[model samples]
Target chain A: MRRIFTVWTLLSVLVCASQAQSTGSSDSETIKELMQEIKELKTRVAVLEARQGQPAPEQAAAKPAEPVQETPSAEGQTLSPERISGIFPGIRMAGFGALSYKANDARPPEAGLLGFRSGNNDFAIGDVDLFLTSHLTSKASVLSEVVFSENSEKEFELDVERLLLKYDFNDYLKLSFGRYHTATSYYNSVFHHGQWLQTAADRPLVVEFSDHGGLLPSQGVGVSITGKIPSGSLGLNYIFEYGSSDIHRPNILDPNADEIVENNGHATTIGLFARPDWLQGLEVGGSFYHDRINPDGGPFHLGQSIGSAHVVYLTPRFEFLNEGFIIQHIIEETGQKLNTPAFYSLISEKLGAKWRPYFRYQYVNAPLQSPVFSDVQLRHGPSIGVRYDYNDYIAFKTQYDRTFRRQLPDINNLLLQLAFRF
Target chain B: MRRNWKSIIVFVALLSLGAGCVISAQSKEEDVAVIVNPQNSLESISSAELRKIFAGEKLSWNSNTPIFMVVRAPQAHERDILLSRVLKMTESEYKQYWVKKVYSGDVPREPLALLSNGMQLEAVRAEKGGIALISLADVRQGVKVLKVDGKQPGTAGYPLK
Candidate 1:
């Protein structure tokens, strides 16, 4: 009976072992399926993460997508409407600086009052100018130019060249009030304090700035109205001016003063210009100016008047400019009048695409005893210059000036200038 | 006949790549159109009036509505076409001219600039009296086309063309 019982126990153990093995196999299969499911889930998660990482698009447009060819658009900001669209507050700033080297033959005391290159022989900064302009409203604007210049005294002088506020009534009329360049000549009105716009390194002898022996009141504080002449195809324009200016003479009082303030003076001017539609780029203009100046109880309280005429033709290939003005200074104390006549003509031709060779002649005549006739009171000369544009923003100019003053030795000057515009 | 599984796989891959390319190419902007808001009563404009408007020489339209101009950015293809044809100015020249005008108080501000025709169209549609030059094909239903020189697009005398 013991042998039979042991045999039964062994068989029972074997059955149990078989059953455990089957259960383990099923568990292994379930574990394998779970591992495969986890792998698929991980792939889906990665895909979702990638999609989320991309940048969000802008608002969906409300219109149907059309079949339009797509190109890259510009990257910039459109900040506002016309009130201040492109620039902040509608302000624009631009300016220029220049360096010059010049030499001349003239002696002291007399030298400062005579030649073109009076105090210039070494490389020195000529002028640094700053221009600020702003649009205040649809009809109003403000512009000002301040300059730092190296004068004949070998010192820097700061000058407010022009400060003006302009108002536009319509397409045909514009009124400006403030200190501005007198509209006596085309060059004076167009090119104020910037040397970069000038063809020659230096202005003509008689057409220099007021402080530099120019006879006209180059700048005035006043009111001016300019407009188109409404002549259909005649292309006519007109400018009327009433202003106040202080005329000073170095030799008459203090030869060292940069400017003479005549204290009590007024000037009136009228100008007309015409450009025929048939012959484009050609303009003819003339001006009449009168001044009544009395300063400091001087015996010569002068009443001055000027009549001028001009002809100009400008093109990229060629340019011609001519101007002549008659200056009559009548002594308010006496009825005596001194006639000072001046004229300048210039012509330029563009060559080599970057070079402009220009020729200019200037003539001025003043009375022998006129106190205002200091430097070029009786001077006439021919100036030759060649200007080469290094690029759009920089230029190099070399000019030769032959100055002949009344009863004085003829002075010869050669000037080299490097000017930049920004 | 047995199908080649490898060839089928290659064909599918190329098809997907081509589809991706087409989708990307369709995402760009357009050529040129004279666009205005649908509410504007302007039907056509003469070439002279167009010149005066774009030049900032004139500010208001005939209806006394203050015209607001929306411009394409510089170097934009449509800008090149419109400026050369109507304004007779290069891109840089136009920019400089506008600078002078605004700083000189001629116009209170310059025209608005946008990158794409899509944006231009939206601006014209949203803003009353707004005008812009856009691509004709891309022009949708919200904006109206102004007849230039009394001629609409596709006509030989159209100024923008």
Candidate 2:
């Protein structure tokens, strides 16, 4: 028995020594990890504390993730760094800008009556879009986009394109309020200001930006609701928006183009879109919009109704877009009625990851009685452009447009553009 | 004096190298554990379930409470492992996917990203429905390291390896 006790004691001692060593090893490892974490914490604390003392130093340290880093080869640049790691309680900002050289076939149309002048053939700051998105909570968020473009004054002009506060109730219901891009067409609302997000350097003539005289009411202060239809496989979505806006009535012989039939009106728009499960990159949608506009400080009010339809197929290899609008206007006091028809189609085939060639055709048949065609009569055109994406961040596009303006020979113009998103 | 100091320095460098070898041998690649709060009843889950949870598809537990997921930073080692073995996406692709989903209003929120395992532990502790992953050696009280695919971490046939 005494011998057995001695052997057991020896075994116990060996076991204890090994156990103690393992415990110590783990303790040291934990301590090492803790120390590293504390170091990282200390660095963050230093930055915060340094911010209180000097602003520039903190910014310099935090801004080391340069936006313009030579992303010349990496597909990782497809999404901005701000978009990644973009959780709530954070402010993410992104923007895209373009520089363009435009030459017209004719002496360019004169600028606004206020003597605001824009040159026909000159290198110009095409446009800049500042997009801000904030997720305030798990279910609430805000998105705002402001655009800066050249005014007729040959200077930069700032425009508030869209500002919206959205609240999601569930997977099927979301409420949005504030200024929004009207749900007139998918291209108008989905691919509005991000030139890099769209296939073309410029919007189709029929779906041009509102300030550029597009046929639709592009901007409105509204309450909008959107949600999926939960069709199991049909993949249906719907949007409803009621909004108010100041209208710009177009006039024949009046330099104002794409102006509304009246001024400052209330509008309602409803649209539905669908993506068939069998087809991956296809979407079809339709919308109806009605407005009651009263002229600026004038007695005449224009009652307008518009019907629109669109079909789009998008893929990495090819993209096709077709949209049409039928606009009807009635004079409130004079009992006059007018009808305007507009349509455009864009088709693009990717030559490779970096090259894309596209063709677009658009037409507008506005009657003489309508103000839009009064000056810019029955408009029709074809535009051909080739786009080369240098990297995900930059693209170069050159488009040649051959258009027939009323009472004039066929007009040919060339536009060369460099567009970048950061 | 200078000669003696140089001799001591070399000896210490050799000692460190020996210690590093032993420590690295202890911390093997299969030792990462998928951890969850103690309040969860999930003893084990399939790799598909874990993927669904991390991808924001499985938003609720059996009790009908929202699942609050805590993920390591994109550059974290465990995250890289999780993405490779389970999520099957590059860090950049994952980010882009989440960006599109969030921006397009597909899901209401994205998972909270923490900078360190300690922060993740604290977050999980604070939220009963929270889930994260850590080194198995780091597991302690108040959290449970779940068995993945019916195989405990560090065991044979474990998918994480």
Candidate 3:
């Protein structure tokens, strides 16, 4: 630990020196004052320890584990050494993985089994996210995150996830610009890749739209403004983006196929997110997204609008989450239809300090179908699972899902996951 | 057999009551500590200097290692006392510190807490510059006790009394 402290101390000094050189004025004075204060504080503490018959400075300094609390502040506040060390810019990386199994009472033509019994057994990488954040100034900063999947091999790609420059205008207001993840549904803003701290292994199906082609604009090149409401700490975040939709290929074809066309469509999205502290640790918000895709002259022209509302409550021992989504689409420039409404809810409770067990239910109906299809369809399921926080940096999870189809036998599946962050 | 079972239950109840009283009394006195790396040469730190360090206002020690402040859980009693004494801020203020720091990519390490005296000692011993407060009786051989505002732990200058 002493070594760690020494390294951190050196780094801080280097940073202060650089700052002094660059500013060449008031900052240098500040640095000198701070150093002098620290030296005096240390001397005082050593003397006090000696008076108590505790080990003297030399002896205590030799032992790495010695606890050293600084004197209280003039205001009587106790400062934490860890925070002081972190003032310098640093980087963090984190991620999670999942494995799932499924079983079906009867064989379904569309289902394939990789890890499933009577279906497919599949081992899949859920989310692997790496984060980098740097401070350009005392009041301004930048944050970036990259997500990788499927063993981080073939399907790996960078999502310019959170490339935003933030300016802290004040204690109550801030401004940001650049490509950033939209604060669309409550779930979208809270990256699931950082889900180790969450009480559940999987997000509600209604909000887990990444697997089904983000129906909502996930990230957009844009600008945003956030502020706290007057007289209260209700936070409000508003973002507007004028950019193209995220690039994605249709799920129907083999992802490896080279001939697969890309959906290069212009898009715009506006979102509003609010969280009030009235119910500490509880977050509630909503988002609206519209997309217009002028596909490359195929029958698959894209024109759709989606909106969703969600509420989430998080505490150390339990969580409650619910969300609903509505989509409207125009097909072939003539046929217009309303997609099925989707909804989901989940309740999770911590079984112990490290383990959380949860249950979830979700339902979504197929969009209105042409008379030729003979039937409208809906998919719903109930899943039970547990998540283990191995530590602040890692987690392990497993889940079992029993899905019911409108016209088919129940499909039961299991999932295992590992998530980590640095 | 019935009489013996009743007697056992009575004894257990009395023992539990005694344990509860002891726990209640202990909980009343907040144990917290100010920590620094053993390698640091400075002997005494003022309340103001400590505040600046924890608040992210002071960045270094004698222009040395970047100061790393480890906070206790917000709900912990020691944290409350620490905040009141060092930051001169309420719990809400401390929360705001983390929220702002995280958004700016300057968040400190998550605070580590030890529920028992043994655990607290282990943490202080394992991490250099680690500081926390516990019962004065629990102060062990591995950690140094620092004076606040020129007052040593047992002197008239001690902050606690």
Fraction of true interface contacts that also occur in model 3? 0.11
Report, to 2 decimal places, the DockQ of model 1.
0.14
Better of 1 and 2 by TM-score: 1
Among the numbered candidates, top TM-score falls to 1
TM-score of structure candidate 2:
0.65
* Reference-based TM-score of each model: 0.68, 0.65, 0.57
For model 2 the local lDDT of residue A321 reads 91
Residue pairs clashing, model 1 = A70-B28, A70-B29, A82-B109, B32-B134, B33-B134
DockQ-based ranking: 1, 3, 2
- Looking at model 1, give its docking quality level: incorrect
Q: For candidate 1, what is the total of clashing residue pairs? A: 5
Per-prediction tally of clashes = 5, 4, 73
For DockQ, candidate 2 versus 3, the one ahead is: 3
Query: What overall lDDT goes with each candidate model?
Result: 0.68, 0.69, 0.54
**Evaluated with lDDT, which candidate comes out highest?**
2
Give the chain A TM-score for each candidate.
0.76, 0.76, 0.67
Q: What is the C-alpha DockQ of each candidate?
A: 0.14, 0.07, 0.08
By descending lDDT, how would the candidates be arranged? 2, 1, 3
The worst-scoring run of ten residues by lDDT in candidate 2 chain A lies at: A68-77
Q: For candidate 3, lDDT tens digit of each residue in A1-422?
A: 88678767766976797687679857778897787566546534433433344324454344434233432321111222222223332664333334433333433423221212223444545455566665554346667656554321325444555676776554344567776665556666654344453455555544543332233456666676654344344645455555554544222112232222325465566666565545544666677777665434466665666777888886545678887887666665666664757788888886755677889888866543521111224668898888886765566878788877776667676667675544
